[model samples]
Target: MPCCKTCTTALYITAPARCSPNGMKYLLPVRLLLLTSCLYRRLTSASTMAAMWPKVILFRDSITQYSFKDGGWGAVLADKLQRRCDVLNRGISGYNTKFGSIILPKIITKETASNVAMVTIFFGANDASLPEINPQQHVPVIKYKHYLQSMIDYLKAIEINEERIILIGPPPVDEKAWEVECIKKGSTLNRKLAVTGEYSKACCEVADTNNINCIDLWTSMQKVQNWSEFLADGLHLSKKGAAFLEETLTPIVLKKLEYVGLQFPYWADIDRDDPAKTIEAYNPYCPSQ
Candidate 1:
């Protein structure tokens, strides 16, 4: 329903200790005074001006909120962001970019508050599903790009700056498992239309050309040995898988928001330049891995 308690506990346990005021152990009185002064300055800086805080809205589909066992990434991200800003989930199951483009305007109208800092567009998974099998069509790579670009244009048309939009590529589909599952479900057409990396690359190109942030969930998920463990089916993430995705994504999202002069709480502790300190999971679905 929210962030995984175990995951949060693990994050804190693995986090590097906060820098102390004293060179030895705890902060001395003099060090504490200096630290407080620094903190005050940081809090009052031009960049940290509270008025510019941005509201974040996530525009995704079924895969992002498949069920209680999956789609928890959005919830997890919302949990971390709720402390710093207004976070809303606008995920609609069985919708694609085409439908999203149609409904997003209505959502924008409802969440009429200005100063929208970020909108994470996580679609294309269902769009990649074939017609006659899934209600959504099998959008070819070229058409898919057009659909994505159209969505971007729609946002810009509605006054959402292109830089504030994020295009999240769909997570990798297990081709073998997908085919098997589709066949079992009597959906032969879908078995032939599962998405591939080339489709994802097209989406990335559109995002890059438009100067929007692109989160490559496809390639990122490929590195994990236990990819199936995260998926409810071949198409959706498992609860554990969603938590892992959230853990991997929050920092990147926060950094992007920060670059645009939006303020949000820092959830990840790893230094940007320090790769070794970064958390890399071999198998987040299983602790032993």
Candidate 2:
């Protein structure tokens, strides 16, 4: 009897040119089974590969929120750590350490902390606001220090130790430039460089007491001839300022992740002829096992 069209197609694909009709009938089922198994293995292996990439959480205020903007520091870090780790931004605009401490636990729980390779605690810009001018945002410098310490303690409790934490203090403000913003909002200058310096100093003290790293943006930017250029509205970071931050933070991040390498083999190492060989080697759920 003549083979059916389905069988004929399977025969051409899976059997030799001289394959008998009976042989095609037997080979098709085995070939289909092997193909299905390979596909399943590839799917599971892809998920496992993704899970292997560590996470770097950027937990901060508007600076970090705006970090993904053009020329933003967060974008720079994301590019620098691509394939090695996932850079997650958890920035909240106008948030102070008091609110940040309250929210940190909700975001970084014990279940998810183990996967975090690094976390940046960047706050205090809003906290340093003058209470008389910006009562809603202002957090006392003393409370700010306690809040930061509490956050560090919480992260440690959840397994994110001091070595994996970095504190970024508030950046310097430009009174001349910021006054324009304050006027637009119907208020006199609500943030002052001197007040911000006080908070930044407190941030460094906390980092020192906890024995963790810190990026004193307030002091670092002022070292330049015209630091105000770094501030977009005499508060937020401009592109240049963001780049400066990226340059400073990248080295520390690299040091922390020195031992971690690329997640998988380079593309050139993949075997094109039998890709399954490479896939199976890396796949822990390979059927043969």
Candidate 3:
């Protein structure tokens, strides 16, 4: 029993940073200290770049919430950043700048916000709702601007500065299609493409004033001859629209991910015949550039 515990302790200290999906099935219960240590190390890394991987946060509304769905932009980003950075989705449905600004601090903290490569702020759809027609989500364009800036300030307080932020303006809406959707949900048409455009431009203004990155979805979509095809339910993005957004962001995201480092060595990079030697050779580095 003494020899067994000694062997287990040795394995625990020398455990590889990365583990298989089956978990420590190869390890007996007595040797589970390896698992606990691995988890604790991962948790600690969340606050600093000392972990196996860095993270990028997607902060947005419904558009971001549905980002991981099939053919969604989030999935595209994840694929592009495989083994480079972990993408943390912090999306909420039906939220605008007012509510988003209030919940900013709750979503992230200084401890968990460290080592974040970039954060994408995507909002304004609900805020663009017509005042008299859709009062529930209506936010004055001017107030919306302030709320966005406030959110940016909150991020900065968490150590995520403007240099690492990307503001995604509300995408162009299809008024005719969206009106039908509103009626089906027991409400009149409460949003307009033109008005939504104004909000998008306003978002750009904030990004410009702060000297951060901005993706003007509104104007960019309009440039496409059939901008309406980009929208699903007149508000969200269709698959093609998601693809467009993904393509637009791929290069930009890659550029920012240059700061992130790989969490662990790739399987192919490891020498299975000499596991101990492979672990010793591990180096923390990012291949994004």
Candidate number achieving the greatest TM-score relative to the actual structure:
2
TM per candidate comes to 0.64, 0.79, 0.78
Total clashes for model 1: 1
The lDDT per prediction is 0.62, 0.81, 0.77
Rank candidates, TM-score, best first: 2, 3, 1
Candidate closer to the true structure by lDDT (higher is better), 2 or 3: 2
- Candidate 3: worst 10 consecutive residues by lDDT? 1-10
Model 2, clash count?
A: 0
RMSD (Cα, Å) for all candidates, in order, is: 16.0, 16.1, 12.4
**True-vs-predicted CA distance for residue 80, candidate 2, Å:** 0.8
Please report the TM-score between candidate 1 and the true structure.
0.64
Instruction: Give the lDDT of residue 184 in candidate 3.
Output: 98
Query: How well is each residue in 233-278 modelled by candidate 3, as lDDT tens digits?
Result: 8889999899989999878888755544466556687798986565
lDDT, residue 111, model 2: 62
Error of 1 at 63 (Å): 1.7
User: Model 2 over residues 21-47: C-alpha lDDT tens digits?
Assistant: 778777766566433322332344543
Model 3 global lDDT (CA atoms, 0 to 1): 0.77
Question: If both were scored by TM-score, which would come out higher, candidate 1 or candidate 2?
Answer: 2
